[model samples]
Target: MEALFERVFVETTVDTDQDGQYDLIAVYIKRPKLDEKVPAVFVANPYMLHCNEDWYDLYDVNTNIQAYPSQNIQREDVTFYQKDPVVCPKKEAEQIVENSPYPEPDPSAYECISDLYGHLLERGYAGVFSGGLGTRGSDGLTMTGSEEEIFAFKSVIDWLNGRARAFRDKTRTVQVLASWCTGSVAMSARSYLGTMCIGVATTGVEGLKTILPEAGISNWYEYYRHNGLTLPAMDWQGDDLDILAKYCFSRALDPNDFASIKPLFEKNQKTLQEGEDRQSGNYNRFWDERNYLQHADRIQASVFVLQGLNDWNVKPDQGIRLYEKLQELGKDRMMLLHQGQHIYTYHLEDSPTLGLIDRWLDYYLKGIDTGIQNESKIYIENNLDQKLWMQEEVWPPKSYKSYRVQGNGNQMIVDDLSQTIYDRKQKNTKAWLDELVLTQNAHSLSFDLETMKEDTRFAGRAKVSFRARIQQPTAILSAMLVEKGKQVRLTPNLDGDENHSFVFKMEEKPSDYFVITRGWMNAQNRLNNYSKEAIDPDTWYTYSFDFVSNDYTIPKGHTLSLILYGMDVDQTQLPFVVTEIEVDTASIVCDCPIE
Candidate 1:
């Protein structure tokens, strides 16, 4: 493809540091060289164009290279390194250039999205790729999913629609306008970028025709902690926001910009610390802002939500819950659930995801009669091994049966009897990250299902209600649905000593055990997920919590097990309390589609 439009750094309308002056955002634009306006597609994310590992290695480090040079001018004649005299002093930018979290990106570098945008330009669509606030060349301190972060996204679309202002240079001398945009836009991205799409879409921003958020989070609370239980600790303890800021926030910068950005860093850090109460994992207004689901009714754009059913990182619930909200609002939406883990469908061989996006964009942005609206609302890969994909008009397929299983000592039975004991002192098994405890623990209880006489799939969250008594005042519990059975295992069968990317051999063998789904809760927060209440020691209370949603099949003869245990390690350092659980086995039933 040929260079069609010059890449320009467009400053957005967000003063992230509350510095009165607006923060600068970098945008690389490409489009057909025509007088007619075109619809635009861009992936809004904090990871700048050149941050991808592949792109970093593909391009040379040229701090002075411009992303898009004038059509008539040679690229070698222009210097890309333009400093902001007001916000980005030369001394600060030089220091940041020397020592930043991420090496400053060479403006000329191209990555996957850049290539994708090139294709978009060829299709007569404009493509604009912008780095998130606080990223390289973009102004402001990064706050992963904060309101300011989301507002930055809205500002981009506003710019396209002529409602927002954007500057072309550091001094705001050259005003770069989105004159080539038709005021119709679509946002597409995976993971965090996708998250930005959701955040912006909820605002019902004008000119945003559609959004495709793959594995994007709808609730920040759900993203980090489940219900009341925080994820296990590795080195850090307390809120997940701390961990997110530690990893995703952009601290890397140009030395010329560092002096202005340093104070912003300290301010953002202080805000994060004060905003998210690390002492308690409960929800607050801070989390409420991040919870896009609450504002789902405000969404005006069509949505194509996709997520891996088995994805635990962002969790399937993130996208699934949003999909459900969109449905309730009678919004134009479609959902695709596949049998992968936090992956993009385009990465899969011969996937139709791109085609779907094209059709969706066409229908919304171009008003083309693509008939995407008539298509099935939901598509799921029913079985991974068989590669069985199924479509339905709605999620939680209506044909599924609900079977109530009661819990007996070491056995899951059809009988319903109330009250089972969960004596925490019974076992001292420690919890690990995302892994089920295969071995029996005194602090845990496990009930097993009989070998399946027929192939059965649990396609949704299993409702678990039980009465429990705690020896102490507080306790955190992890419940997991596990499958234990022999299955054909595939291992790489290699020839010679070389491991080729596309040329891999496989050997099949028998293996046992796979963790299907898991859920967590704090004992005191049994009634409200966001609030904690004191529990009297030895007083029996009926606690109800749902297991994480799943779509997994237990082949005939395989046994399914429900294991409950206390998580010793936690992000919030709450004192460990012993818990005893009693349950009516009949109250525990898996509600899902079988076929």
Candidate 2:
């Protein structure tokens, strides 16, 4: 065992000035007898090992180390002691009495337990612990100040410096990897340590309720309750930051305490809420600004984020915002948005998701250079077609072309073969136009496209433009894509009011050659925003609706189709409209070009 054990000794140093110190160190220690050619791997949890019990158990069994029971034991071989059986050095023990600034049974007492555990585990190539504040009290509004919190956070820098020492002693290299959770303490620790931190966060909402049987309040709602009110079923609730502010206000036991924290909390909550409202109906507000992306510009370590677009607890855009901010910061980072809800991405399949996490660790902690550095990828689960689309680039690729709807008197064609309009009174025209306004039931108008000569692979934005006059003052136009011949509805099944034009944006997937872009205009506001272009009498003001891009393969000899309606069959409420629908060919453009 002695021969197999690496001759590495770990020590720690502190740099109080914030200057980069003990930098450019390897992440792991290697035995002299082992091959020097392989790179070392480093892993850490700033909190106690119990916080990550599964990982702790795995590492203990793999390394053949004796697992510590929940209770502590006094053993010289065990460098650290657990909180259940407190241990203190003789000299520092006296300092607790002479110089202690905290009240009796100090909130920081847990630090001693954390230190003892860390000291024992310091023998390993890596360390792990929790760094964030723990929620206490029945309402889950109060935070506990434990010794473990301080040790978990402070020990991150300590461990990094120790790993550097271990590398120097072994004549090798070392890396520092940290993981944590929660918003306040985790972020606070990250700001102080200036090291790479990885962890999952919850906005206090349960995303599992989306697919699971159990239903609970969303994090936003919890936050709202903490703010002394419940969310109104219908109303534009400002922004993400505003919601968070409301929560903070509710949670403040003493409104004057930590007064500085309120403004930032409010601002972040509103910003996150607004962005989320634009993309999804889920009440979970997860914004990168207050969590991961706050210090993104200064982070030197590679960041990897995994999130779910369909997660009802955390807004998917939080991951996107981080990815965008990382790109802007010119940092080495990667983000993966899967077709899953919260916590589902951790499961393994024939094609495993955990395998991806392994690879990410291999590249970052082991410095293996797996060629994933400085790249971004998005995996969109097409709810419309039930397929996945993987794109490598920034958000909303600029290459997407915006196709316009053009056609008058019914038979619509997109390609440049020929322009022909069909009138009920005319001959030689293929199809006739029928204008039906939706008054009571949702009205639908379908158009068949001309046959295609070859397979067309479209990649980009798709939009619908039409002239609409509502019988009532206000109306909503709901659009959807369907199969040309089969007339299949290609929209995802969702729960909510369909009359809202913004609700249409939540459809993560739409069929190829089919799109639904909705418009809500009151009859009093019939005048279109036609300042840039002239409106032809033949065509009423053309209103454009944007849809999520569809990377669809239209088979040869098949036609493209579009459906316009006032309401979805599944929706409770209905839209009112008077429609003269026309479909036309429109150019599609991407949001950004891929390099």
Candidate 3:
């Protein structure tokens, strides 16, 4: 096993930093030594290779929203992001000898979960790991979701298939061939690594068979922004594409590599920052290039989507959009929406939705008839019962029905819009919900929904529409649908478990409610999230959007309610601006899928 392990650099076709040559991708090969060729499982990730010394640092969130634009945004601002890459400087690239310019790759980027990859290798296949272009040992700049970045990942598979070149060392003297493997490849991982799988699969690159994207991102725009509002992932305030790119610009770790590309890297940062559109938070060519769903027609590979329904980091919508697209295309695909947070579900118990991923890969990568393809298209974990897994032939289930409520009386959120935002810095969700249900507050609007007579299932997204106008030119609009009674819920097991799985726990004294799902948007982005036209003060703007997809059963006798609030403590950004919202209580419309 030791003798078969080797590190190599696969040459890519682009020079993201344009330092006079095509970029190189750093890869580590682990294939079986058997005479019979096997398939390969490739992981093209930025996190596992050379990485930034530190994680993403927050940007200044104290600033106010961008002033409403008086006119349509400049065309140059949109088209510039789509400019073609510069012509390769190196018609015939110069050879970079081992350790000549960049240092060796540090394998400590990921926790090296021997349990997962080790098992795959034992199944008589090769496993390849790569920190895509612009990581520590690789050339180019780290621009997430760029065409160059996607092609660089595809380049590794090209190497495995003998269509691209890879050198055993920087000398470019001895070549490392994937002679022990078949051309078929599958990419399987969680988070950004999984997202790369979607990006590469969209290219429809030959020899790439399938992908298992667990908690992967399909649209980079949605990841960083919500309805024209800068909403960074997790609790990372003020984070955007540039900050994320800077975080993965791992090449800076090597002194020699850093010095050679310092100017280029700095320029890359400036370009990224400018294009990210942090101020307007509107979608542009920058976001469009990163949206893999738009190119779904090019995907030839089978896809198996796995996402944590409770995951906010990558969000369920990331997997939902791509999987639905594949379903619409009549492509071979499957989806496993689990109750866990942002995590891999292979180790989670198999009512066998995820465990079948092994079989799915075998069918695609090794031409095995696993019969997994004959199974249902969707497998969703029951949020009410973590151990129970359910399957459905179609989304929303056949029995799905809509439950809705309209605003009864107008209510106002008391945050002062005339002044800079300071009141919403640390809004508490639970406390806010408590006020809405137990002690009605002036800062939010709550509508009591029909109570469920029997245990009722809700699967799929919930849409909220309402007519509202604020005292200011712009405001943040947020909504939530909740179960007004306590229920044991699934929570992530963060106690250092090997699986990083989930556990169902009931609060000693169950809380007042559980927010089924929620959504937010910059109210000014009414026509679409990509548009940011100024809203006339006191003019009614209709806001409508779907909350994150969810699957749960509201207990019998438990009432449900639709809560409209000024801020979402978890997802939205801080300035609880907007002095008051003149809401048409009767204008609130909810399309809730109940089964």
Candidate 4:
């Protein structure tokens, strides 16, 4: 068998001076003959052409390098050597040379042709190159346009694919792995190429903003200057990047220390016009960008997104909604929400939520079927048990049952019972109009049941059906659940002020041991139509409605109580009212037979 290798050098000139000296030089190794069986690798270098002395020293002594028989070719067969390599001017080389002696060299420095050649050969990769926008020496990093970046990425794939046909005459599938923003751009391109793209969120210009702020540095450029950290010219940007960097740095500090600057990031959430501020626009933009609705359709990969739920800038809801959209789009994707903010943290290493991301990515990328695709696998920490609970269905399952509210005196029981009441309007039907003023502290009337013979479990949605005449034109109805001799459990109100009959759905409750479900109607919407089985919409009627369902387990000794009331129950919010009312059991049944 014969081995083939080709060496090529690229010299980039900044000016058309025709001088022998070139502004930049690059070396490349092409093994077009061996392209079929190996992965294509590209190493890019923005500075320097030859191997650094340290790398040469390692090459001379390291057993790993010596063990590779293929890399050590016969001296006679070696075709290329630089007789008198042009070096950078002494003054310019001083800074570059001084920083070269560090224990660990910048990974970018080793992106030369020979270094990349050795890496690919040692790793058994066949395709390799060292050209891109910067190959022509036009400030490769920043000066590289988005189009050129796209082209460079495509060229790498093309070159590799080209080799497969030329070398082995067999077509091979290619996969790409990119670092930094290059990964983001490459992944975007991969979407067009119909290839799977795997990339790392690398440290680069964006990283500087995050890193510098955490280090207590107010200004990124200033920090670099004072700390002697090398600033790659490609990292340099206009004022937008600088401003963003400063903003990020300021936000990195604790809110207490920088209370004044907090408003800059915060959005004004007030509903009234008088409370409006600059934060309003900022918030709108933030929500617009962070909202799942924005990129609901753009995601093309089997995205495994790991976002910090506690991230101040990017809320957990953002990722949650994105995951939901992906599910809606029927894309193969997963999302992991952790307790840490913005970036992954070592401090949270021992945290249980931290491993969720690792497990998810491992299962998706590594082709390990870890059962992550199961329906609604939300691992929520149970506040009661302090352990993660895996739910098969959605969080707070929909199979809850609501027990209709029935009353004997002030006592409430979970049962179905009819109450004949006087119609307030006609004052003729077996209905009585009882006027109750709507107040903030309006007591929710309850119908208590007789002592239970056996325990019962009630879990699901609960509601209250009532018929009453409103003295005023409009009012608000609110319902709440309360354990016997305890405060109200969960309270939710109707959407708006109205004078009509309607059914309100309580937010789903977790399965638990409980006695009753309760309901309430705003006295203002007291109009009810007794002609239909449900309350009427046109005119006021007479009947205090208590309808509750879902599911709850009643212990043997506990009594089930149903309470109905009018007015907003959230103490922090404003209040409303309800007028006349009559209490009765609502006759609504679940479609599915409850056990």
How many residue pairs clash in all the candidates, one count each?
22, 53, 3, 47
Ranking by TM-score: 3, 1, 2, 4
Better of 1 and 3 by TM-score: 3
1-595: candidate 4 lDDT, tens digit per residue: 1234432322232211223333222233333333244333333322222221321110010001000111222323322221233343311121111000113223353332233234234434333334333323221221211222222333333333331011110111211121111111111111111111211111111111100011011121221111111111111211122222222222223345235433432321121111211111111221111122433354444544444432323333334444455567776554343333344321232234324433443343343576656634443322112223323233123454445444332222211111222232343321111221111122445445434466443333443444443333333344444334222222213222212222222336532222233233323223321011222334555533333222233445545543454332211011222233333334312121123
For model 3, what is the error of residue 216's alpha carbon versus the real structure, in angstroms, after optimal superposition?
A: 0.4
Scored against the true structure, residue 388 in model 1 reaches a CA lDDT of: 63
Q: What is the lDDT of candidate 4?
A: 0.28
TM-score of each model, in listed order:
0.79, 0.39, 0.91, 0.32
How would you encode candidate 3's per-residue C-alpha lDDT over 15-85 as one tens digit per residue?
A: 78676666788787766667678899888878765456475677776555665764466545554243565
Which candidate's lDDT is highest?
3
Tens-digit lDDT string for candidate 2 (198-277): 22212111110000000111122221211111111111122233332233232233345335344544454455446433
* N/CA/C clash count, model 1: 22
**Residue 266's C-alpha lDDT in candidate 1?**
68
Give me the overall lDDT of model 3: 0.75
The list of candidate 3 runs beyond 4 A from truth reads 1-3, 53-55, 73-114, 350-354, 398-406, 416-438, 494-496, 500-508, 576-578
Q: What 10-residue stretch in candidate 3 is worst by lDDT?
A: 96-105
